[model samples]
Target: MKKILVVFLVIFAGAVQAQEVLQAGFKLLENGQFAEGAAFFKHYLTTQDATNKTALLCYGRGTGLSGNVTEAKEVFGKLLQRYPGDFEISLNAAEALMWCKEYAEAKRYYEKLLTEKPNDFAANLGYANALASLFEYEKALVFTEKALQIQPSNDNAKLSRKYARLGLADYFVKNQDYHRAAPLLESILSENATDKEALFAKAQLYIQLERYNEAEKIYQQLLQLTHGQTEVYLNLSYLSFLQANKPLAFEYANKAVESTATQPQKYLTARLGRITALGWNGKFKQAFAELDSLDSVFPNNNDLLIKRAGLSIWNKEFAHSVSLFKKSLRNVPSSFDGNLGVADALFAQELDDESKKYVLKTLEYYPNQKDAKDFLAKLALRHAPALTTHNFISSDKGGNASKNYQANVAFDVATALRFNVGYRRREVSNSLENNSANVQTMTAGLRWRVKPFWLITGAINVTKLEKDGAVAPFKTFDIASEFRLNKFQTLELRHNSDVQSFTAGLVGNQLSFKNYIATYNLSTPFKVGVYSQYYYTKNSDGNTRNLLFASLYYDLKATPVVKFGINYQRMTFEKRMSRVYFSPFLFRSYEVFGVSENLNVPKQKFLYQVSVAGGMQRIEDEAYQATYRASLTLGYKPSANIELTAYSLYSNSATSSVVGYSYSETGIKAKWILLKKQQY
Candidate 1:
């Protein structure tokens, strides 16, 4: 019995010694001393052939830490194969694959581990990291939440959750989903209030939503917390610049430069911020000097090259801007910013084809770029007019032969407001009579954005008509508000009113009308809307009209721009008309098709749209009429501040037998865009 007891003790002591060696090896591997740890683990495994799960896991970890990723992966795989239900082996394999950057494979292993141990903190955290690496941020947040739930006190797990949340927030911000990102950033700041990164993100979100006061508050808080950290000061400076607070912007920008640590990134950001502030404050010379200084500091920085290009564009140095943009593209061959900058410079130089090439190149890399899309749309409108021509052939009563000539010009304007103005003019002649009727009008408005969810707008219309010894003038004033109900739904309220007096040929009419309308619009790739309107008239009688309208607009997004929009309106008269009236009086119905494109010019850009619309309206059986109206417009911008527009209108009513008259007009206009109290 004594001899058997001694043998048993010797065997047990040897096994314990092997286990201690394996633990020590794993500890070294964990601390990143991989080669020596791997050697120790190999020796221990050789002496003890039937090593337990812990020793096998340690061996795999050591192999991975020593840069033998293949061997580590195979070791973990064998362990998993032998102990199929072991979460530890599964987690080890997942972590090794993560270090190797095999994010998809790591995610598979982590998910399998979680299936076995639902609350396993390591597995959940590993899964989050894997998903994050793959840019599956929404899914990553789920795993991060599980990890937090399992180990609430684990700092690593908490930090991982925070990062995942931040990733989600950034995704929203990039997609222009400010309303969604704002709350997420707010939650992050509420939890870790001193997190400078989160605070900066929150401030940017506020700025995008146009909550300038809130953004300023958060920026000030960040500056206080960071004691004028370079990033905080730079952001504050940008905010000040946007709000037109030049002195404060300059002060903060200088502070940003002074506070930057001796790091390339810090110095670059500070210098760029100061330069931008100077440019926005109208100190172009100082801004250019700062750009030159930046060039001296970081001669090879592609980011600085891009910034200089942007400054050149702002200063109207188109040739220099193009050169800098092209140079930056050499350093960063796939840079979307560089491509876009080059495109803008080319556009400014009126090299439409060359500019379009760069714009398309940018779209190839960044398909969802809104600025690129808008620029392309504008370009399409610019070149459309020169490609098409029209002629008017007509003969009237009194044995008179009538002929007319018309021309159009189109263009675009850029500011906080983006506008497309078009104009067309006509000249009429006859053997018995000759008169030039000029019809001039303009349609200019912007999608006024106060926030992601709220918008307010004001637009105006002026019309002048010339004919036989009579002048007809019409003007409209409009105010509207739109609210986004969700990603796909919006509600709008609009008030549009027009006052006009007409005297031409035997028709002399004066009318004043006001329309109050509300619309519920839902949009996807296709747009659908239902609207109701109450119109008050102060012309022939003090009457009111209640109208219900529905419209569907579809876009094929194809070349040649195939768009189909149809609207149906039903009118109910509150007071009967003196003239015969038709029931369910179809207020407006039309189908339009056209091709449009933009043309780049030396001083400005042009937008040309040509469409043919035909429809019919009914008042009664005898009063019914078939209507065909051809409208053409040309808008020209010789410079940012100068615009010339011409417009023409020709219509004929079969029932009225009054071959609808043709009128055209042209006007030269100038704008002071940045003037104080100009109400652009």
Candidate 2:
């Protein structure tokens, strides 16, 4: 019985081998004669057991190649289950599954082979392709890179990488990230300059960005490289139509249809371009004829339908445009262009509700549509009244004199100019001083946004002062430019030279001081900065003194809203009159530190910032002062045009005692933002 069993087993093995040869031949036949070969392979699979792995693989391939997807999937699955560890069989099964469009199963098998041997180039490439087909581009890129690394010379892997890159570019483009897509497309073109697809993508991007010159260059390059390919010709013709070059546009349109490319869509594009150019060039009848020809060729094409609707709308044929829009919507019910065209036609026909319905529908389909957004904004603004508000206050006080206040209403005429006129009052409290004054001042200024980093300002202040003894009148002219280096740095240069004559208690004292200072400052939290100023001052004694000053500061933010800063300053005078004093009249050194917290309020307003500062100053060894100062400022915004500010400053100095003089004053102030503008 053992001998008989051995002979039977050998006979079965021979039969299996013979069947495998027959199956391989059948697969070859399927490659050459698909119909008859598929019949033979199917008949053999039914009659003979396909336990032979190679035979089963051959049967799977034959069925897959012959378009018998369901049968091919079944056979591949059986082969995988029976020969789980066979890499060749698994790869073939995966390929068969891919042909069947069973991507998930194909990916599973490919991943299995890859897991066993990651450097399996064929498995890696196949897996990546499967992932790309499923639109999993980012994951596909990883495997595609692996495949290229394993076999750098593989053209298939290189092409797969190109597709992956193009996929990523398209993804970014769909998300409106044009900046990201631009570099990827450029890299692809660098690798293959004549890549017509990448060139076309670049042209489309340029068109969307309104970069007509760049778009024209790319379209011309594509036309030359592709030898007047129909798509390229159509692109060029459309661009010419946009530029109103009728003759050139019609020539390119003719060339597009004359090309050997067989795509019907290319012919339709050519027809549309030619018709649009003819209509724009005043050959209306000819343009209509071209549309009729397109209708004859593709009666159901929705794009052509929409194009006809647009032409009707442009020609003021409201009824015709409406009919075309409705017909197009039968095929594409949610078409963005069709809905927008219907809305426009209804609006032109005075169908308000219908127009709004279609417009809202268009926006529902394409929420980011620019035309729809603009239309909605304009409609909203039509029913709302624009509001304007303005308020301002100004106050000043001099030592040993009465206080003055000015109230004004400001109006903004333009970004660069503002007009303000208000009432002013001045009074003294003590009867012995017997002082009263009143004057009205009109102030105006011009503020220009010279650039994103600079502002130019010029203002004039005319004032009238009255005292018990005499009357004093003065005018001041100031011009300044503020420079912004970055978020945290600023420099201001100003020229201010004014003359003022004072009266006694009622008229104030005759004291005059004139100076022009140019200052440079740099400010940043956690950064070291420097400030310098040079000024020339003339006192009532007719002595002119030149002052040079420099300060170094560093700021630290201990919390989000609290900032602390320390500064050191050195000042020098240029000349001294006393022969006993050979050195400069003023030599001062100072060091100070302070902390401030910023308060933010709603409606475009802010509040200050109470801070305490302490420092020391020395003047040429003649007098030294240790100082302590505290300040409180309140900022109020009555309107967008005005800010009212009031602050109190208190300081105690040791030098005041040594010099037989002490100075302390508190003041309130308000400023109006006459003009505010920004430029880039």
lDDT of 1 by residue, 1-680 (tens): 00000000001335446666555765576566877777877877778765566666666777776788889899888987898866666677778787677888888877777788878777778888888877787888788788878877877766766777788888887677777887777777788888887888888888877688999998889878987788888888888866757779989988998987644458878888888887766577888787777778678888888988988887767778899999999999789889989988877655667888898888888775766766775565444322112344444342223233333333234322234343333333434434334444554444454554667776676656566657777776688898878555778888887643221221233345687878787655222333333343333346666666565666543222444565454555565543322223234433333334332333334634454555665543445445555555566775443444454545443221222223332332233222122111
Which stretches of model 1 miss by more than 4 angstroms? 1-86, 115-119, 261-265, 282-297, 370-680
Return the top candidate by TM-score: 1
List, residue by residue over 114-180, the lDDT tens digit for candidate 2. 8898888888988987887676777887988898889888777777777777787777766667899
Looking at model 1, residue 31 earns an lDDT score of 66
Candidate 2's error at 162, in angstroms?
1.3
RMSD of each: 21.7, 22.6
Residue 341 of candidate 2: its Cα lDDT? Answer: 85
TM-scores for all candidates: the values are 0.51, 0.47
Give the per-residue Cα lDDT of candidate 1 at 39. 80
CA lDDT of 609 in candidate 1?
A: 41
Residue-level error in angstroms, candidate 1, position 288: 4.4
Give candidate 1's error at residue 128 in angstroms. 2.7
